[model samples]
Target: MGYDVDCDKMKDECGVFGIWALGQSEEAANFTYLGLHALQHRGQESAGIVSTDGETLYVHRAMGLVADIFDAGVLAKLKGGAAVGHVRYSTTGGSHVKNAQPLAVQYAGGPIAVAHNGNLVNAEALRSELEAAGSIFTASTDTEVVVHLLARAHPAAAPGTVEHLVGSVRQALGRVSGAYSMLFLTPKAIVGARDPMGFRPLVLGRLKGNWVLASETTALDLIEAEYVREVEPGELVVLDASGLRSERLFPDRPPAPRLGRCVFEHIYFARPDSVLFGRSVYEVRQAFGTQLAKEHPVEADVVIPVPDSGVPAAIGFAETAGIPFAMGLVRSHYIGRTFIEPQQSIRHFGVKLKLNAVRGLLKGKRVVVVDDSVVRGTTSRKIVKMIRAAGATEVHLRISSPPTAWPCYYGIDTPTRQELIASTHSTAEIATYVTADSLGYLSLDGLYAAIGAERTGFCDACFSGQYLLEFPRRQNHAPLRLVGG
Candidate 1:
């Protein structure tokens, strides 16, 4: 069989990169590529890079993974001192080549390449306003809206002035609302900013005398960069020859939200190796498993994880329950996220094509399978069926997260309420629906212990229906209130 992009689609968040050459143009692309690789978990739809020398800007964007999109030949063609890159998964816009990012725009002044990590709740409204004023769009992504806003926001100044560039970002921020951790690259320097709420992550690092900015600390770790610190919420930071400068964009925008951080960053989105908001992602997931063990103890001969995403939690479950942990399902690592089948109707059939049950390990065993979370129920049901077909005596399902009942508006590609399986089914109902012997989910409180209380905070609207921000009243659905589990 030929290679097919794995179509087992999950909620994907985009990754962003920023680089200040510090007179070293040769290594910027390599550093950004390694950084993006560490952040590959953040997105898989496409990868793009934009770089600027003191004189000119270079851009290269294509659909696929970072390795697929740029090689030495491609990177050589992109020459610049300052650079910014993006790996994108379009949650708000239709996925297309035009939607691939580090979107470069040519304004009346010099060009600016922009890469963004979060969602804008007011995108549609903002797009409408721009369209009303005759702004033409090349991509459907909300990121393009920022460029349009910047085109208007750009102050009239003499060419090559930093004032004009910084002013544009400040102006765009005034007009847009919602979550964002963005990087802007001009010909001379790289600028990074986070929304006042800091719903997404962005960090500053230094390596070989150059400064770097990325969506996750793991990215810095991969490139052997020394992490300086997280870019403070509502702070705008500029990196250039003079060095790093910071300013608060929203000094009066209320007290720092106690719960403004993105919750899914801990759950299914981030790489387990990542350290988010002070807690290790793997440690937090293991806590989820331990919590699951305490809340819903189960009887089984072996505790097996679905692999990769489920390993940490399964390890926690096995340790807590004093059961042997085995590898139950093994995944083929060759496939890309865009793995397509012949048609949409049979698209999900690709999951089986990517993963297989180890009969020798699972045969005749009462197996407890742990996974991160179940979105639509299709994958879980199929996995259970596979275990049964492999001669498993009983399949007990353990989920490391509470039921996901709401669609994520900040960035994750969760489905609407009608399409979410847990939103429509109870825990017992889900167990029956997936054909598992029994099932249990970790509680919200359990997550705190898993990730630790002092290190993490989340916006768990999907589990408990409490949006950290006021719910916007939609014309299609009534205004939502904070609902408890």
Candidate 2:
């Protein structure tokens, strides 16, 4: 589902989960599995888990959904008291089993595993440097570069001590740059760290007497863990037998004027039930609808959401505009990755496979369709046509978020700027292309008001073209075949 050919939604980044359960090795794998299951919406291309007993590490990873990859038989084999897990969508690597994480490896110091949830802007440069110095890489993922750095870092303490592991991790991360919320599982502890800019989310929680770390609060909720606090940007937290302790990753650098938290999390990426960046996602989305309604008031018979993501916003829009809210379109949750297509006879069949218009609800109505975003505009155009065919007299499209004019380099997978319809066309031109009676996107200022936060603390580069960090220009490199395992 991560790489749906017919879907125009922005591709999600990866999700990371880690747990430190002292004297509970038997339950660690099970708990990690449930955590990953809750985070499945973030990524579905691959899943993995790496667990550690006091003396040994066990790993299992595959290219598939989390539920499909792990079973009773598989989880039973991953014996450990602490563990780290990952669900990946490959923002910087090829989609192969080798790229699936909790990338486990044996180095000079000992065994270590890491689960990463963000992209590294300097990965290619670091990889080139490592390769030049005689390091061999087994996977194409940016995560593998971190592992190599850890292997080469010189620790001042003894090889297997907690100090040794923490020192090594700090050294490794210091050399790399960009948006990363990572979990490292050493035999001695489970460690979590976020980038200095806070471009992604990583939270701390507790279950019974055990410690937990996840990319979002929803994963903690699913595991029945009590929500604790976020692992702050530029902070490194270590959880061992003695419990949790924290350290600053970049103490020397002056504090940034603003945190670079990804704004898309509140607008689209996160589940409605989740809390992200100290705000309730559902409430924020409803506020988005309210603000959108205030910005673009339309005279319509009914306001309908464009299925799952738009439901909250649409409800708020309807309430604010004094229009009735209805489910004019229904989405099919059971759509698979592949299906047979009628040869050259069906148009917009892909959209039809996933959504169906409610003829009775839309018939003879001036319907307003609300959606989270419009990516390439192909899906939106098809959906508008479908609504028209279902007897809607007038269709007005309202977007909950501002136009996505630029690609995301932090973690998300998005089309190039040239491919985005809003990058070149005005709102009126886009409305014409999509064949809607009217189109309105929430203003950038309205979005900030809805979130009840200052614009200084967020990375709205996709909307404002202001990136927190400078990324290297894209370069053509020869294909790298699988090297050594």
Candidate 3:
């Protein structure tokens, strides 16, 4: 069962999946269930699935993990030919069951189920316009904005029935702005689309005769699906019994289309086992560590990681620096990695339950402790203090990415700018606050080098102040209502 846990860290927003096939509605729901299970790591707060057998749509959603939401009894009830699933960590709307997605709606065109992976930048503007037009909203999610837009749209051209419906959706899609990797499921077909800047990851795959779409390739791997290719930026694909069809949403292709792919996907969000932006997340993380080691070589007797999240970079750092790598800090895998300690007195209690320093390994040693990123610095401080208590003669902290100095507005749940340690403090100050003898972070250029991709085509908003899209001049700094925080 999915349980709620609080910790000082970046939270992933959501995972989306949709499957459609010829004569496979009975099995489509099962495939989607497994796919959501594979992507459970992305979001653990709530999960839901919507399936359709061409004439009717079946929906089941709840505030819990996918494993807890469904079973043989539930799956048997969801007999359908096409299915779409979502696992969510609230970003825009609060963690209410009403906000849970594969958000099904009935309109003039009939049943539509939508699943989304990224936030909308201009959701407030769009929501206001919809409300003025007499639209009644049930949830305060940016996704429902699209539904309202669909209400006002007319089929631009209708040579066929399915094409007419797709045209109507295309018309509504043209009116929006911001990062979105969306799945639109109808009785007749399943559709997937990515934003023009492509700020989130979405991939296409196939299982037997079934066509599958998901936020990460790992979802496909779980069901033994063969990966097709990434859904390109500004591209919308429609899958039905006739098969897959695609159209570019923003067809004004530039000489070199710049896809503002989220760099954080490689830095932390994506599963190491998944391939994103055409690179293995594991390999990229290792590269980030290798690059960090190049930038910050330390004289230490041993190298250790902060635990599970820090292990990959730690491995890379150890290999690159030729330092001995050991589990100096061990994580309690049995404990919910997401443990909660709401009381101020128990703040340290939560981190302790998750990780503990190994006194035997750290005794009399100069340690190089590598971690992925330091967000609030509170947890990192507690960790460093624990390592000191474990008898480490010295602890030099190393990070695999540039310090996050800004907040992310796309699908990632992060502390506000004021809460970000790096946003208001210098590296020296951060080191002092964390109580580390010394500290080092990978350079921005080094991070780009690790990805082996040109930096110009990526979103580094959280690291650099430059935003890929234009922000409103009068910023409220309020959390987006359409997309989860």
Candidate 4:
């Protein structure tokens, strides 16, 4: 099987977009398509859309890019006044057409569709329990467990009733654990829910007096929607003909004392233009760079980012350090999933295919490289060598985020702790491994300062090894130690 050549970085699970135009003549599916297109960076393996025309749900799902999977014909066929869409990169399920989402089904509560953007830590256990109770799942994704849960919740309620649907969603979500930012589309309404801890991002917006839900504000910008506000952690907002209404998933329990918003969203997953947790993602990234510069001051002739993800931080570092900033490396945007492996003689052919050093700008310069994070250190090593080959006199490495030492159980695709270089190696050792003259990572305190939030409000589990929820323990895998307790 061909693997992603650039697989060393962390990957988000998926992106979700939903729109409710109830009595309007808007093309909900088309708006959803545009929103998904803007969120395409969050997930690229597959895309799907489901819409309801008040009585029936229409779905078009395929294993490909959103643009490739949807066209005028497909959108026209998805006739509806409300719709939900998903772009997926599997974290809890195998990558295949069967797992493409906006999972639509008919149940005791009538036809409903779901688009989910996070992982359920207890999915295996839930799947087992459901199976023992005679639930037959068509897909292996953790998201399917949710559909079944909703299908079984409030079995006594009359089907097709709003009360039944709302009760089913609340009851179903209350039982699941771990990160989730979900959207449910029914004949009557579109509902958006966030996990109580708020490990994932979901936001609300307004487009022509209608309600729109998206994983990021960038999607809202693409659709020209007015930015409303973030869907509060633990809150459920239902959008329908009567308008938006809020409910608490756990009506009795108080909200989590410290919301566990994923810190990595601002660092890498979200588009720089997005507003996450009421902060501009671009501004936060730049602050991370500035903080990194304050913590690790290195004398260098020029500072260059790793491109795209690294740009904002690099700019911040350069401005704060008073060093010349340049695009010393140029990245190719067209590299696809498939590529023929070159002979072993072709050193670093994979990395070269995606990035090339600008010899004219980098040669003879004391180059400081800024990157978002280092995973296994293999890619960083290659990048370092590439810069050296371009005649950089000295290569200093600076990372915007602290070392990621633990695997994420909440939707991000990360390597096991054993595979993470930082999990076992120290900063000096990692510098030597990556062949950098020196290395620095933004301190945890500096990170929180840049975010302008209390550490208690966000989840830095990947860096601190403090998981908010207990995850399933599998044989042969070491038990994840949760430091939150």
Candidate 5:
């Protein structure tokens, strides 16, 4: 009966935001709300923020969008000069209020909170160790493991200080393994750190003397913050009333992993306006379209995108390949990712609910439909069929990214290899399944060329099946690796 956020596309796990000011008069709670609103595209299942005004901590977390979870009165009650916030799209745990973050826990260091934007490859191993050591967990999230680890790592008798708090969590992080861009919120300071491999994006910014940290620069732009720099790979950033300082979390670290950044961020996860991994998301997507045109050229009357996400790439493809672009497929903007079918009599049901073919334009035209990526082939198949039913003479499907053949372990939530159409079927077989006259996916080399980066310098695990973390290769299990080893 109510609205729920359920995206059919491959979704990133979450986004994080934090703000801290010393003598400045910024309302952290209000600004954080705006930052999260800008990042609402990153996650929509749950939202939360924890605030601290030097002594006490206030937290509010619930299931739904940022606006649905907070109000003027709620933020006013969160009266603090510093805060940490998160919008979640569960990767490690189920969707529930208990699994929502900035997971606040009371330890020897008073009350500390953590907001994370990644998955832990060794979370199961760490949880087992903690449970064996008699630790109790209230949530089914990998983040809870950090809470217990910090408690055990800290000196039980010492009162928690900013330095001690960061140092303790740094040691704990050293022992765990996986991709994480995290913020540790304590009464004294907010400490931000990234994994040694830099698998996710996190940025630093300053707004009217207030220091800020976020998963994307777009968040900073929404609040009029001056863009700082990225939280460097393996770096620890500490922000407080005095200002911001830095430390390295992986000085004596794992074999200098050549490069392990996530490429999917550019392909689909990040907002088009966001600058990530040293390039504009919009530009990279356009490149994907250009490359797709080069790799697979088809004579067609018009080039049409599969609605919103594919628009940029489709435009590039049309321009490069010398084809006219048209809005052959119209998307219902009001349809919020998920909706109840108004009636069962509607044809092509679910897909039609979100997208409808423009019969007037598509009729009698040989059209090329471009999309960002093909995960299961279900949506692509539906779109192809719908176009044909709309009277298109021929339907050709073009994917900007490579075939998603492997599962992602770092931060992305992907289907198993058995479920990924590419992993189980050949290119020809996939085209037949989708009922397209022709099909083409950008090559892995073509993707790197699009991004202007060396193939070895990024994480294309979902496409290439070359994962970074060394874990036990088992069904649905990439056995966890120790971070401190």
Candidate 6:
């Protein structure tokens, strides 16, 4: 029902965080801003910051990008030895300033601000229960559920106690289900926690004596912070007077089942320059294209990528296929905001303003078009039609990753079952629907090899329809496949 013009329909969410100790003299907000800018590709909706001077907690949050929301004056206002910041993309919240992150709540102890990076599967039911119990909600965001739970878990009388805060968070997390990587800001410390599955990323780093936790290591690199290590799945870290301390929150759950790092992190979600799970995102994506070519061979005069996200994989595909590659389509950097435009009519029209076919490159070319993944056929179909209109002799679509058949309950914004193009149709049907001359998708094995991660270790739930974490039962819209993208 939302803007359905784009053929491939996955919109990724990004979470970024930065923090400084009470004694540190550095401007924590500015460093956080730079880190968020580096991670901007993950989310573009809202930004917030909470800083503490050891005695008082200061906060500023709004619905806009980091660049648009925070300036020198705003950063100066958030004066503190320590701070936590968030850049958000709403997978389950309304796109308004009220729903913006660093959701803060005051108690007798002090103020606690939270920034969350993933979605909670049980949010709807939880919100209903809280609302019925007299919880007045300010924002219709799942994140506020945490605050409600925390308030109930920790009594107001408990003051200046990290143990009580941790206990409250643990109790709150015990009742919720699904992926989350969150940063908690108290006047005394900044804390980080990851869900048991580690469905989203949270990494730890250090700059001088200051500590930082972010959704990706790339953020640390941007601010010249030294990468300490990834905050382990189910691990809770507190940066306080005693420096960094970690505790196991969900000890009963066994170690990650092959460490289900989200495969899409490299395919489409993460920045190309970012490193994840000790591997280069750029290198992995290129490998994905190379593996895809080996698995799905096709004859073509030239190979072309779908631009931006698909460029790395497309290059790999071209090299592996021994075909020449060209920048066949150029993206318009001046495209208007898709979420802010008054209606879908404007957003759909905005797509054209963002992308244009290169007639000179497409003319008479037998092009093998490479893309990261296909969601709904809308965007892919439009792109194929555009290439044909641009005079390409034939357009063969090759996807580096496998088709997305299931909705992601973690963080990525994938449509429901009925809206997925691949869920209801076979590859051939999808090809015809998208108007591509021929179509090929990377096999699950090929995709595995592309990223070079252990097959037993990564989470391909979106592609395979298999879930590692226990989730609330939903109707099985499609049958599970042994092989996935």
By summed lDDT, which 10 consecutive residues of candidate 6 come out lowest? Answer: 476-485
The lDDT of each candidate is 0.82, 0.90, 0.85, 0.91, 0.86, 0.81
TM-score order, best first, reads 4, 2, 5, 3, 1, 6
Candidate 4: C-alpha lDDT: 0.91
List the candidate 2 regions with Cα displacement exceeding 4 Å: 1-6, 342-347, 475-485
Best of the two (1, 2) by lDDT: 2
Q: In model 3, which runs have C-alpha deviations exceeding 4 angstroms?
A: 1-6, 157-160, 252-257, 337-344, 473-485
Question: Could you say which candidate leads in TM-score?
Answer: 4
Question: Of the pair 1 and 4, which is ahead by lDDT?
Answer: 4
> Could you estimate the TM-score for every candidate?
0.93, 0.96, 0.94, 0.98, 0.95, 0.92
User: Which of 4 and 6 is the better model by lDDT?
Assistant: 4
Q: How many clashes in each structure? A: 3, 0, 9, 0, 0, 8
Instruction: For residues 453-475, write the lDDT of model 1, one tens digit per residue.
Output: 73235577777767766535665
lDDT by residue (tens digit), candidate 4, 105-165: 8887888998999999999999999999999988999999999999878745677877777
Question: Top lDDT: which candidate number?
Answer: 4
In the range 305-414, model 2's lDDT, one tens digit per residue, is 98888999999999999999999999998886556665646644878888899999999999999999998999999999999999999999999999988888899998
Better of 3 and 6 by TM-score: 3
The all-Cα superposition gives candidate 3 an RMSD in Å to the true structure of 3.5
RMSD of each: 2.8, 4.6, 3.5, 1.4, 2.7, 3.1
Q: Candidate 1: lDDT over CA atoms? A: 0.82
lDDT for residue 159 in candidate 3, whole number 0-100: 31
- For model 3, residues 304-410, the per-residue Cα lDDT tens digits are 98877788899999999999999998887677645545665665577777788999999899999999998989888988999999999899999999998778877
Question: Which regions of candidate 6 fall more than 4 Å away from where they truly are?
Answer: 1-7, 154-158, 252-258, 339-349, 473-485
Q: Between candidates 3 and 6, name the one with more favorable lDDT.
A: 3
Which residue pairs show backbone clashes in model 6?
Answer: 6-378, 6-379, 7-378, 7-379, 7-380, 14-42, 258-457, 332-354
